[model samples]
Target: MKDLYARHRAVLPDWLALYYDEPIELTHGEGRHVWDAAGRRYLDFFGGILTTMTAHALPDVTKAVAEQAGRIIHSSTLYLNRPMVDLAERIAALSGIPDARVFFTTSGTEANDTALLLATAHRRSNQILAMRNSYHGRSFTTVGITGNQSWSPTSLSPLQTLYVHGGVRSRGPYAALDDAEFTAACVADLRDMLGQSRGGVAALIAEPVQGVGGFTSPPDGLYAAFREVLAEHGILWIADEVQTGWGRTGDHFWGWQAHAAAGPPDLLTFAKGIGNGMSIGGVVGRAEIMNSLDANSISTFGGSPVTMAAGLANLSYLLEHDLQGNARRVGGLLIERLRAICAQLPVVREVRGRGLMIGIELVRPGTDEAYPQAAAAVLEAAREGGLLIGKGGGHSTSVLRVAPPLSLTVAEAEEGAAILERALRSV
Candidate 1:
C-alpha cells in the first residue's frame, strides 16, 4: 500500500494535497459501513462530507448505472436527453418550483459557479455578498465569494465582499435574535455595502444550513428576512444546497424547506447526493432569471446520459423508500442521544444541526474559545473505535460533523453514537 501511494504520488500533481489520504484502502461499502483492503469494517458517519445521502452501492442506483452504461453514455447538451429532462422535471416538482429552469454541471463547485454566473448575468451586477465562514466552491469566482480566508491564498478581486455573520451555536443565546432586529441589522449592512459599491451587488449567496461552516443552522425567520432585504436591493438569493439537498434535511425534500415561511431562493444549487456518488450537479432557478443567459452561454459535460440516469434512479429510490422520513427519524434519535451524552460532559459545548447533518462542537471547559485539539483527539479516538467522522468550519476544527447515509438503520445509529460517546470519554 505504501509503495502504491509512493507510485501515485510520483505521477500525480503536487496540488492534489487537498485531501489527507488515510492508511486504509477502501474496497467497498454497503449501507453505512465501509471496508478497507485489510477487511477492516468501519462505520461511516461522515458520508463523504454529506454527499452519500443514499449510502454506497445502493442496488437500485447500481442497476440503473449499469443499464445506462450498457446503452448510451454521453450525449451533447445541444440535444434533449430523456434522462436529463426527466431528472430536471422531478427536481422541479419536488422542490415546489413551477416551471423551474435547470442547468447541469459535473460537480458541486461547478453547480455553484454556474449559479453565481447566472445570478450576475441576470442582475447585471459585479458585486457578490456571501456569509462569512460560508464555503461556496474552490473555483476562482466561487472561491472569491467564499467567506473563509484560510481556504484561499490568492488575492480576492475587488468585486466580491463577504459579510461575516455569527452562526447559531457560535452566537450562543444571541443566536436567536428577533426576526425584525436581525432583518434590520443585516439589511442595513447590505444596504451600506450596496451604496459603497454604487448598486453593483448582484446576489446574496448562502447555505440554507451552512455545511462546512460548522453545520450551523440559521435562526428562525432569518431566511425570510434576508430574502426580503435582498428583494429590496434587487439582488438574487442563491441557496447553495450542494450539501443539504436530496432529502437529507428530513422534514422537506430540500433543506431550504426548513426555512418555512422564509420563501424560496431565486436560485438553488445542488449536486452531491443527486447522483449517489456519481458526478452530477445542477442549478435550478426561476424561469425568467435562468432564461436571461444566452442560448449557448454555458456548455460542458453538464448533463450526460450516465449521470442523469444515476440521478433519476437515486431520486426514485429516495421517494420510494421515503428516505426523507427516515432521515428525520434517525437524525432525531442521534441528536437526542448526543444531547443526552453532552449533558454529562462539560467539554461537549453544543450539538447542533438538523436531519442527517449534525455537528458536535467541542470547546474548552471554562472558555468560549474552541478546543480544536480536543476535537481532533475525539475524531482520532472514534477512528480507533472503528467509526469514521469528519471536521468542518473555519473556527471549527472543534466540530465533528456526522452526516450518515439516509438509509442508516436505528441500530446502526445507536452503535455509532455509543462508539462516539466512548471516544469522547477516552479523549
Candidate 2:
C-alpha cells in the first residue's frame, strides 16, 4: 500500500486528494461493503462519493454492462442508439420538465457545462447566480460558479457569476433567524442581487442540497421563493442534482422537489448515482432552451450502450426495490441514533442531512470554530473500526459525510451508526 501510494503521488496531480494518512487501495465491493487490498472488509458509508446509487457489484447492472459490452460499445451519437434513447426517455418522463430533452454527458461537470451553454444561449447573457458555499464541478465554468473557495482552482471564467445566500441553513448571516424569517431574508437577498445586476441574467444554477459543502441545504421552499423572483426577470432555474437525485433524499424523488412550489426548474443536471459508477451523466431541460444553440454538439463517449445499459438496470433495480422508501425508514433511525449519541459529545456541532445523505459537523469542544482535525480523526477512526466514511465542508473539511447505497438495510444502518458512534467518541 505504501509503495502504491508513493507511485500514485509521483504520477497523479497534486490536487487529486486522497483520504487518510495511509491510503488503502480498494480491491472490490459487494452490497454496502468493500474490501481493501490487504483483505480488510469495511462497511462502505460513502458509496464511492455517492456515485454507487444502488449497491456495489449489483448483479443486474453488472450483467447488463457485460451483455451490452459483448454486443457493441463504441458507437457514438452520430448513430441511433437504443439504450441511450431508452434511458433518456425514462429520465425525461421522470424529470418533471415540460417537453423535456436530454443531453448525455460523461460526468456532472459536462452536464453542468452543457446547462450553462444552453442557458447563456437561450437568454443571451453570461451572468449567472449561484448559492454561497455551493460546489458544482471541476471544470473552469463550474469552478467559477462554485462558491466554495477550497474546491475552486481558478477565478478565470467565461461567465460572470453572482454568489447568493440561503444554501447553508445552520451557518450564515441569517442563521440566527427562524425558518420563515430565514427564507424571507434569503429571498430578499436574491431580489436585491437581481435588482443590482444588469438586465437579462441568464440563469441561477443551484444544488438542492450542497453536497461538497457538507450536505448543507436551505430551508424548504427557499428556492421556491427565489424562483418567484427569478421568474419575474425571465431568468432560468437550473437544479444541480448530481449528488441528491434518484430518491437519495428519501422525502422526494429529486432534491429539487422539496422546493416544488414553483414546479420544476427549467433545466436539471444529474450524474453520480444514475449509472451506479458507470460514468453516466446528463442534463434535462425544456425543448426550447435545449435547442437554443445554433451549432451542433456531440459527446464521443457519453451515452455509450454499455454505460446506458448499466444506468437502465441500476435505475430499474432502485425503483423496483423501493430503495427510496427504505432510505427514509432506515435513514430516519440512523439519524435519530446519531443525534442521541452526539447530544452528549461537545465535538459534534450538528448532525444535518436527509435520507441516505447525512453530515456530522465537528467543532471545537465549546466553541463554533470548525474542527477539521477532529473530522479527519473521526474518519480515520471509523475506518479503523471496520467502517469507511468521507469528510467535507466549506470550513476546510470539518464535516463527516455519510451516504451509503440507497439499498442499505436497517441492520446495516444500525451497524454503521454504531461504528460511527465509537469513532466519534474516540475523537
- State which candidate has the highest lDDT: 2
Which candidate wins on TM-score? 2
The 10-residue segment with the lowest total lDDT in model 2 = 191-200
| Clashes in predicted model 1 | 0
Residue-level lDDT tens digits of model 2 in 76-138: 999999999999999999999989999999999999999999999999999999999999999
| lDDT tens digits by residue: candidate 1, 1-427 | 6876787778998666422344557799998999877788999998777777787899888999999989988876887789999998888877666668898999989999888878888888877888877888888888788776655557665456657353343563345557556555655665666667666578888887888877886665666766776677788888888988877878777777766586788899999988888999889989998889875664558888988998998899888999999999999999999899888888887898878889888888877678888888888788878898988756557788899999989999999999999999986
Number of backbone collisions per candidate: 0, 0
- Extract clashing residue pairs from model 1: none
* Models, CA RMSD each: 2.3, 0.7
The TM-score values for the models, in the order shown, are 0.93, 0.99
lDDT, candidates in the order shown = 0.80, 0.94
Query: What TM-score would you give candidate 2 relative to the actual structure?
Result: 0.99
Give the Å shift of residue 197 in candidate 1. 3.4
Model 2 residue-pair collision total? 0
Q: After superposition, how far is residue 205 of candidate 1 from its true place, in Å?
A: 0.6
